[model samples]
Target: MNLNLYIMLKSSTIALLILLSGLFISCKQSKGLTVSNMKKHHIESNIKGLGDDTILVYYVPLSKMGEDYEPIQDTIFSKNDRFAYDTPSNEPILLYLFSKKGEFTRKSGHPYRPDEKHIVALVKPTDQLNITGELKQYYLDYQVQGSAFNEQYTQVRKNYIEATSEAVSIELKLDALMAINGDTTEINDLFQKRNAVNSAGRNAHLEYIKNNPDKDLAAYYLTRQPWEIFGKYYNELSLNVRNGIFKNALESKIIKYKKYTQVQEAELKIKEGESAPDFELRSLSGNFSLNAVKTKYIVLDFWGSWCPPCTKGFPKMKAYYSKYKESIEFIGIDCNETEEKWRKAVLNYDLPWPQVINKLDIDDDVSVKYGIKAYPTKFIIDKDKKILAKFIGKDDSFYQKLDELMATK
Candidate 1:
């Protein structure tokens, strides 16, 4: 009676591929044409089976798209909460799938619209796809049910004077204890502890499910929990963790967190006009010099073997380098890359730039030194070895700046 097997079977990668591929092809059919110049498009999932048990997500990045696509009405979606959508218009129908991950789409349905100059994703649960739609049913038996139960639980806990408040209070207390502590020696130490606590909590939760194999909590915990946790706190938590380095330390161990911080420190050092600190890194090819790439204008690019965005940008860089070889020199600084993957990426990417790897076994020193808070941070330097400008992200604005600066020189 282990429902986990069914859940696993339903949530297989193959199923997602099929569903996504279907969506991709559907978007490409030129015959079913709908043309529009409207400010925003209304989107909803035509989910059929689960009458009232579906979660929907919609995303809009204001910075990218501007203020054109604001919802005309309020857009909350969960069904069973004190603060549940009051007016019918308040229900969020635009479920944004783009915020979480990338999906294949026809070139015509590219996420960015040409004239709009914005990126937005509208997503919602659909009965058409059995997995994302019935997520609620999988959590019905757990003490912590789906978003609905969570919403109800929150209200129940908040209304201490009301009935069932005591039970809700207990659950909240248990969650607080099991969750990672936020205070610790260093941010690094805190993250480690938090991860350990999270691991322990998952194990305990799994054991509970094993004993209650018929229950859906197992599926909820394994499949839907990541979405719930991540969806609820993705943006805020990301910003906080990023800004948190200065605020306070985490109570758990986070290896990734430490790596990011180290990279940040190095970036700051280089930004403050410190000498481009020298570090030797081992690559698949051989040891190479980080400082050796110094030229009239060095373009130090941070990338990894696994990143898709890196692959897309490398070609453009190669083309740019070829056009301006005498005026500029480019250096590829590999980050968190395995030797095999590094070599393959270089060959596949057809990167014409001088490439080097960090052999110091350092945690991505190039990224750290250049204040490369993210991938594809490019810095323009004058012949005097001073930084001209730092491009934050790999976008058109970045290239525009490069062209402008190169022209000025």
Candidate 2:
């Protein structure tokens, strides 16, 4: 019998998720089950129905979860989703039920009360589930196909292991080339597929070689791609980037692939030693500029309201601002988030700094001037407009750096 490739692929992904979840949960246990025992303990019984797309799997929960477990049905349980009761309470096993909605519609008898421990699931014999044997054959066929495809994928990636090793080499070569020549423009052009024509051209060259590697035409066409032109194709391109060496060559052709992205507009460009760029920025409070706070050291914080880390970092920033308001200032440039979310996070986090919005992206000329790339990039500027330090992420070193900068000259 035959089955849809999409369903087969989706089931395969679910299986992989289950394996990963099991591994993650098991890591916390001191006496984890052996791999052979794990396979034996896990029961997976497949049932195919009149609706050929859905597969009904009946199995007891893992070693940690008991059979009397009541799975969370509304918020947690879905037919196709995995669930684990035997594992840690925090780590629920995946219980994938084949359903059209891809979600379980059943509500828990308890209704939002997550503390309940015991529940029961009904799994009848394959001949008793009211499904024909023909449909079951499709399930069997799909399982075989799925397994074969997975094995092939694993082998293909393994075959390209040496080629993948070339990625680091490409990075090193690019670094050397950049060191020798101040201009990165030519190298940048190969990676940038800003236009549709360029994108289509790049993909076509990659696909042709990938599907037809034996032909001289494919080789010639692949050599014409950008990565090949730079003589770094073998070492630079990723497997997902396509066509092995040829794809790597094309990838190297794309421009600014490794360039830093600006997360906000209205960002200042002045370097640590250079005079800070002058700007008039507007906020709900009113327009303000750096000149107004010339005597105070300032921290330029770039973030988005939607960013969770950005939200978490705000309280620490608030504490620092509260401690140094008399001698230091904070100018926040909110980027790539909605006005509502931004305002909400500010109010929620109780941010004390002078906040402003930059509608333009961080990569714009204004952001480029400051060399801003990632979110929550904090820069400490002295009263004389010299950059003292740059901090990324919430780490012990970041706090230490901040304290050292704030300690005084």
- Output candidate 1 Cα RMSD: 19.0
Please list the residue runs of candidate 1 whose C-alpha ends up more than 4 Å from where it truly belongs after superposition: 1-254, 272-274, 283-285, 293-295
TM-score of 1: 0.41
Least well predicted 10-residue stretch by lDDT in candidate 1 = 1-10
Q: Which candidate leads in lDDT?
A: 2
Q: Estimate each model's TM-score.
A: 0.41, 0.41
CA lDDT, candidate 2, residue 66: 19
Query: lDDT (CA) for every model shown?
Result: 0.40, 0.42
Q: Which digits, one per residue and each the tens of the lDDT, describe model 1 over residues 1-409?
A: 1111111111212232233223222221112112133322233222223243222223322121211233221223322211121112322232222111222122344322110111112222321111122112111111112334233322222232222222223333333433454233443444454455435434554454345333323322222123233233223333433333211111111223445456556655676344555556664466766555555666666666645556667767877888777888777777655567778878877777777764333454555556555555567666556666666445667578678878988
Instruction: List residue ranges in candidate 2 displaced over 4 A.
Output: 1-272, 361-366
